[model samples]
Each structure stands twice: as structure tokens, then as C-alpha cells.
Target: MLVAPFPPSHPLAWLDSHAARRREVGLRRELRPRSAADPMLDLAGNDYLGLTGDPRVIAGGVDALQTWGAGSTGSRLVTGTTALHDELERELADFCGAESGLVFASGYAANLGVLTALSGPGTLIVSDAANHASLVDACRLSRARVEVVPHDDPAVVDAVLAARQEPRAIVVTESVNSVDGGLAPLRELHAVCRERGALLVVDEAHGLGVVGPGGRGLLAQVGLAGSDDVVVTVTLSKALGSQGGAVLGPAAVAAHLVDTARTFIFDTGLAPASVGTALAALRVLQAEPDRPSAVLRAAAELADAAGVPAPASAVVSVVLGDPARAVDAARACAERGIRVGCFRPPSVPEGTSRLRLTARATLTDADTALVRRVLAEVLVPVAAR
Candidate 1:
């Protein structure tokens, strides 16, 4: 078995061609450095409840750093899990009304962990066409027969699940679609899954700490939180104003994941700082239940100002049909001291570029006024251009 040596070429040359193609289509992206003291009004981040910089949350992180020495040191199955991790998992499960919970390094990993662990060659994964990329990637990695049905249509899901040849099935979706900020019909979806004997896995990344009673999540409000057939995954980074993610389900499911889920067993445990800050943030949410309402109100106000419908959650999307136009609109907002998120392909569908604004509970009246003015005087003209 003799192999001939090939002619030499620059190892990274292919990247230049790809970068040029992206630039031609207005899809190129670059990281913009942010300073700690930049005085721009922030509507670009996911801090829905505005607790990330809270003194209490900061103190929680500081204390954990002093105790845990900054890192988890190893994977959870090795030496990553700490007493803080255990406490956070227990409190998270209690808050969400689940029998048990397992923390992961990030929400993406949690999605991958659960989907890969639950489905395989003999499983059928019915995923929403508009599901987050994490779930989509997880399905591809699961070796399952995947069928993507129309967005928010439970009837289509039911039909697909009924026609699947696999013995075990699962339905994957998000409680709130990030781009359009529309709520999924979880009740209907749950009914279909239950009737078809399929497991329903809903990502509450945007729903937790922003929806439901006391911000427990949409499933809890619907009385489905601890249901045997329903599993929920949530991120602490959003309304919780921290980092890390968790999967909430039966104690049996958590135990199985500890033994089998690749992401959980192989990835480093979430840092003690993140766990502690998340715990403190959860307590803050519990104490100030009205914070969730404030976030909703802010979202509605922003949407109204932007001439869009009130969103289902704290995210409000303003669609600008062309990618270049959307980028210009975002830049105009930025020039006016407003920070907003610019979404283009493949983060969004082609020709549907948008400016994604997130509402915060801490937005003052002046901030709201500035956003309204930007939407009118800056964004409107740039989007038109």
C-alpha cells in the first residue's frame, strides 16, 4: 500500500474563496470588540431580566471563584462536578418542578446531549423545521430517521409520527422561536406526542425565567413540567443572567444521561462561578416576581415602537428584507448610541435579514425613548434605502 506524495498547497487557501463568496452576498461577519465601559444602550444581548451585573450576582460569582479557584478542572464524570453544581441542579429542578436535572457547559451542549442520548437508529426524530441549529445538528448526529415538519403545525407532526417506521420517536422544538418571537403550540404538540407515544423535548432557552408563573417556564404554567413524557432543556444565560444550561426530566432520565450522554460525560462541568451566579439570579427572580412582567412590557413597547406585533417573549424582531439593508439599519442604530443585533444567513433564512432587539427589565424611559427614536429616525430610513 504505497501512497504518493501530493504537491504542496497553502493549507488555509480554501478559506479565502469562502470568505469572498460570503462578502459578495452580504453574509460576511466579523467580531466587534466591546469595552466594559462602552456607554451604548444595549438591546443586542440576551439579558432579559437585567441581572447579569447585579451586585448580588457578582458577589455570588466572586465567592465561588475564591472557593473553587476559577475552573472545574475536569469533566463532570471525572472531577468537574462541585458542591455548587449539585446545589444549582437541585434548586433548578425544584424551581422548574421536575424530579431531577443535569447541568451542561452550555445550552447547545445540553440539546446535543439529550437528543443524542435519547434517539438512535431505531428512533424517529420529528423536529420542527424552525428548530435551533443545535437541535438540527443533534438530530443529524443521532443516526435517527428525522422528519422536519412545517413550523408550529402539530397536525403535520402528528401525521409524520404516525407514519414513521421506527419503534421509538421524539419531537423536538423550542418554546419560543428566536427569529419571529412566536410561541409554539406546546399543548397541541404535547397532545400529539402523547397520543403517538413519542417523547416531546422542548427547549425552554427563551421561555424560562421570562414566561409562566413566577418565570418557572411555559411547561410549568401549562401543568406539563414534571410530565413523564415531556422533557425540557433551558439555558441559564438568558433570563437567569448567568451561564450554563440544564435538562429537566425524571430522575431516571438524568441518571441515564450521566451514564450515557457524551456531551455531559465528556465536557467539563460548568464553572462554579456560573453555577453560583445562576443560583443567586434564580433567587432574585423568585423574590422579584414582577421582573418578568416588566420584561414583557418592555418587549411590547419596543415592538409597538418598531411597528411590529408584540412578541411572545422578550425578543422583538424587525425584518429588513435585504441583508445589506439590515446591516445598514443596524449600523444606523449603532451610530445613534443604540446597540442591536443584526441577523443574516445562515442565522436567518435568505432574504429575511433582520435586526433582533432584546428587551430588558432594567430599560428606563429614556432608553425606551431612544430606541423608539432610532427605530423611526434611523432604522426606517436605512431600511428603506
Candidate 2:
């Protein structure tokens, strides 16, 4: 029964103790299984236009599955490329006003690809403090000298870029911050980059199909859609109600990514069904251009009911003011047949703990009212907790 003797206490053993602590602090995370038919008001997902379950979109996926089979088989360079991928790229670029577009397996991959390929050892990356985790990781992996600046501060960006001695630099930001749904001052940021001869990269994951006129996205909405100096990334899983992501920018930038973006070069291509579903969703947006407006109205109405500011995008973050209360509030909503996003410290900025509810275009009048009622009832008590 003899084995190598060691102290009962070790660093690895601390993981279990940490889990217990998370449970006590109400910060533990466990996957909640759901049946396909689970009947709950879903405000925690990113299916903004609600095409995720639309008959037309589902049919498109089914057709793609039947025609293309289940797996992509290999990296896109080998067996994964299809005419559908090409068509999606073309339509997405034209709609978003980018000269070209490159699709990725996910928005995370797309952000990493753009950053690594465009930046090198001496590149200076000035990123917003509120940028998504994906962009933050990209900056870290790019080997660029990175400086985190205050949220939505164009003046801070200008100061950073001016102070940097490196001649080659890139400015990164999110058009709409996920938790707070606050819009960035894109034009001012773009102008600063222009003045400093730096590149501006925007992650528009939450803004596409929810911000621009006709849902073209934040860049187009802000009149920077096709600019040669700006590069933008978007997630199809969001407002599109599909899966995958894309980067839109100059033709040269797209070409450079194809050459050096490790994610695209090494990872398997997105599935055909995803391509088809996203295409269907984009067409849905085109045919019914008013969905974005309707969703905005619903969001505004819901915010008013909660006595908080309306969301700038499809995301609405109800400030719960404390981490433990935020978790409790989310659980309460789930108990009442509503689901919402729960964010706490570390996931969110240190002080901002809130219930992040995403809006969808297909939310019926009754459904939205239920959302307001359930969310308010669950959270109003948390304000004092």
C-alpha cells in the first residue's frame, strides 16, 4: 500500500477548495442541461433576430446538411471550402461595405487571426479596457506592446498613440461593449488613428444587425463601413441567429489574413450548415428590415419598465450593484420561467455586477411584457441586497 509520500496540502488540491469557496460566494458555474423542447423565455442567448429557430433558416440548414454531409472533413484549405462560403463572403462584404470579407470558425478565431497576422514584435496595440476577451487575448498573443486605455476614451487613445515611439501601431476596440451595451466613439477613435498613421480594428460582435441603418452594423451605421483604414469583426451567432464569424476590411488586409492568419490557415472551416443558416438569416434581415427597429423599441420599453436606461444595442444590462445579488436575481428570474445572463467580478469590470439581457427581434408583445415583469420582480429586491 506504499506510494510516494507527500503532504496532503498542495497547490493543485486548492482547486477543489476554490470550488467550495465559489459555492459559498454564489460564483460557482455548472452547466444546466436543457431539452430541445424546454419552454422558457430565453433572454440569455445572442439570437437577436430570432432566426435561430425560424422555419426558413432551419430548412436551409437541413438542406445544407443533406447536400454537404455532417463534417467539413479537413481544414478549409483542403476539403472544407465550398461555393456557399464564397457566396457568404461576397454578400457579407457588400452588405457591410467592406472591400472583402474572410469567414472564421468563430468570432474568437476571427479576432485572433486579424491581430496576429497584422501585428508583429514591434507593433503597438492600444486597446479599450472594455474590449471583449477575444480581442484582449489577440493583443496578448500578437507580441505587440499593448497599452490598456480607459473605456470609450478617444482622447486617451490619441494620447497613447502619440506617446508610443513605435511607428507601426494598431488601435483596437469594440463598437458596442457587451455587458453595458454602451456604444464607442468610433469616429473619434478612427480620426486619432488616422492622425497617428495607425490601424483601427473594431469588434462589432453586438452591433451587427442591431446598430446600423437596415442592420448593416456599427461601422456602416457610423459611416466608417468601407473605409480603407478600418477593420471590423462580427459574430454570426448574434443578431444573425447563426454560427461563425467574419472579418471585414480592405482587400489587402483580407489577403494578408489568408496568408498569415493561423486560425484560418490551421483550423477546419466552418460547417456548410452554418454557412447556409447565416446566409438565410442575412436574407431575412434584408427582407424584413424593420426587425431591428422593433427589437430596439422592445428594449427601450423593457428598460423603462425597469427604471433604467435603455440599451444602446440589443443587450440590456440591469445593474444589480453587487455580485451575490446579481447571481440571486438571475436564479429568481429562471425560477419564474425567464432566463437572463449573470455576470460578476472578473467576468465584468470589478465594480459592475448586473443581469445582462439580450433582446431578440421575434419577441412577441406578450413575451417582452413577460420579460419586463419577470426581470423587474426578480431584480428589484436585489437592489438593496
Candidate 3:
């Protein structure tokens, strides 16, 4: 039998009304079940390099699981740190040219951990207006005075930093923005941060394995990788096709995070399987330098077909104006054997709901042709409407 609903005066009653409002606005979200072998041409996911199904990556994960069991067993400070974890951290730090690296359970956790630990009452944080949601949430959680500058404009960033009276400050930016795949002015931002004696924290969640020579990342491209004041956070789940996140920085910062970062201190360590798979993926990336370039090529091709600017990274957005139109476009793609992402309000600004597609290195010419046809067919009707 169905239980009676909560009373009208109950605190949870507000959620029902809010949900109804969302439904009216076509902003309500639903979880669509996906099978393991969907066989659709997938452009909606973040597996840019397409290493998730690579045999070597799977082998690495299997080996680690056999050796370390499944879970990390405890938090890193307790029994969580395994030999594989140590090796992965060392390799990641070496690969990225950072003095030290620390792993977190998820990219969200890593962003939260670093931002909260680094910024305090005496510190000011200048964030880009179009930064990721994780960064936005992190800034809020930091309790620091955060000034959001115009997106990708380093001059405004400089002005804000110059006007700040805080004893210390940090500038946070994503190397490649998650929404439109536009590249940030990293060199200019770094210069501004350096001149202001502020730390530069870059989230390389999208750029780490899809930008720079051999995919070292945008910081490496701008010669800021090993800089003492530059800190980077990356997710193993995106380009690496693994799971977990890591903060790369100077040894002192890493040490401080270990002692002070609540996410690191309290959360369970990243699983051995993810750590090993990331290690394998990194090594594969080192060996197969063309994969990164292939990802770029695919994104460029997709953008050209869609009449959008070439993507700076693996993501490309096709604006569909409203949430309902965007959803229709995505569903149309699905019916045509393509899986495309639909971005509505909250994921994007109210007026810019779009079809967000990610380019994968593993996508074939046939896949490209199919995408071109499906997008042309679906987007035209949506655009006309």
C-alpha cells in the first residue's frame, strides 16, 4: 500500500513544489538507464582518448584488483595507502612535472579539498565566471572572499587582483572550459597571478590529456607546469579513461593538503583498480603520442560539420536555444544511433541550452560521417523551430 504523503507544513514540502516548477519549465531531469553494451556512437561522454576499453588499461586494473583486493580498505592516512597508490602518485607527479601529487576519491573531492584548504579569511579567490560547477561549489565551501571575473579575460583578472586588499590571493581557472571547450588565457593569467604574488590553481579536468605536446596539459604548454606557485588538479576518469582525481603541486603544498585537506584526511582512498588503470593509461599516452592529436582532429571535424568553431579541446557545443529543443535534439540523435549530451539550465545558462558532444580518439571515419548526418538532420529542424 502507498504511504500517506508528508504534511503540508513539513519542511520537505518545498521540494515538491520546486520539482513541479521544474517540470513546468521543462528543466526536470530523468535518469535514462544504459546497458553495458549500448553500441551507439557515443559523443556524450568524457572518454576523450578512449582508453577505458583498452586491453592494457583493463589488464592494469585487473592486476591491481588481484594484488590489492577491490577497495583501498581505509583512508589514505590510515590503511588506505597501498604500494600501487604510491607508485601511481609518483608516476603522475613525474609525468606532470610536479614536485608532488596527492590523489582524491573524485574530481569534485579534489577541487573541494584544494580550494578549501588553500583559501582562508585572509585570502581572496578570483574565479572565472564560466568555471566548472565543482569550482563554484569549492569557492563557496572555502569561506573566502571570491570575485568572479568575466570568463577567460585576464585583464579583468589583473584588475581584480590588483584591487584586492587580502594578505594572500589565489586565481582559479580551467585550462579548457567544460561548456564550450574554449581555451583559457593561461599564460596571461599566470603572469597576473605571479605579479600579484598569488597562487594560480588550474583545473585540468578537460585539458590534461587533450592539450599541449604529448598531452602534458595546458600548463606545460605555457611553461607553468613546474612553477612553484602553480597548482593543477586533474581527473583520471576523463582523458585517462580511469577513475579518481589528483592535485599536483609543490611538495610543501602537497604536504599541507595531506595534513589539512578534509576530503583527503577523511575520505576513503581511491581504489587500487583506478590507480593502476590510470598509471597504464598515462604510460600508453606516453607511448602513443598521436592519440591526443587524434582527439583534436575529431573535435575539429565535428565542429566543422556542425558549423561551430573548432574546439580547443575534445568538447564541442551546438546551441539549441531552449531546454525543450535541446532535449528533442538529443533524443533525435539517440533514435538515429548516436548518443549526444543535452545541456539545459543549471548545466548551462538559461538561454544557452545546447547539445554537448565530446570527440574521442577512437571514433572512426564512419562514426564521423554518421555524426555529420544525424546532427544535420536533427539540428536543422530544431533550429527552424
Candidate 2 TM-score versus the reference: 0.96
**Lowest-lDDT window of 10 residues in candidate 1?**
1-10
Cα RMSD, model 2: 3.2
Q: Residue 267 lDDT in model 2?
A: 97
Q: Is candidate 1 or candidate 3 better by lDDT?
A: 3
Model 2 clash pairs are none
Cα lDDT tens digits, model 3, 1-385, are 2335567999887777787799788798888788998989999999999999999999999999999999999999999999888898889888888999999999999999999999989999999999899999999999899999899999998999999999999999999999899898999999999899999999999998899988989998888888998999999999999999999999999999999999999999999999989999999999998999999999999998888999879999999888989988899999999998889989888899999999999999999999889888988888999
Cα deviation at 126, candidate 3, in Å, is 0.5
> Which one is best on TM-score?
3
- Candidate 3 residue-wise lDDT at 351: 91
The global Cα lDDT (0 to 1) of model 2 is 0.87
Write candidate 1's Cα lDDT for 1-385 as tens digits. 2334333476766766776798898988878899999999999999999999999998999999999979999999889999999999999999999999999999999999999999999999999998999999999999999998999999999999888889999999999887787888999999999999999999999999888898888898777888989888999999989999999999989998999899999999999999889999998999999998999999999999999999969999998889998888888889989999999989888888999999999999999998888889976677567
- Residue-by-residue lDDT tens digits, candidate 2, 125-170: 9999988899999998998899999999999999989999887999
Task: Report lDDT (Cα) of residue 120, candidate 2.
Answer: 80
On TM-score, the stronger of 1 and 2 is 1
Which scores greater on TM-score, model 1 or model 3? 3
Backbone clash numbers for all candidates listed:
0, 0, 0
**C-alpha root-mean-square deviation, each candidate:** 4.2, 3.2, 1.8
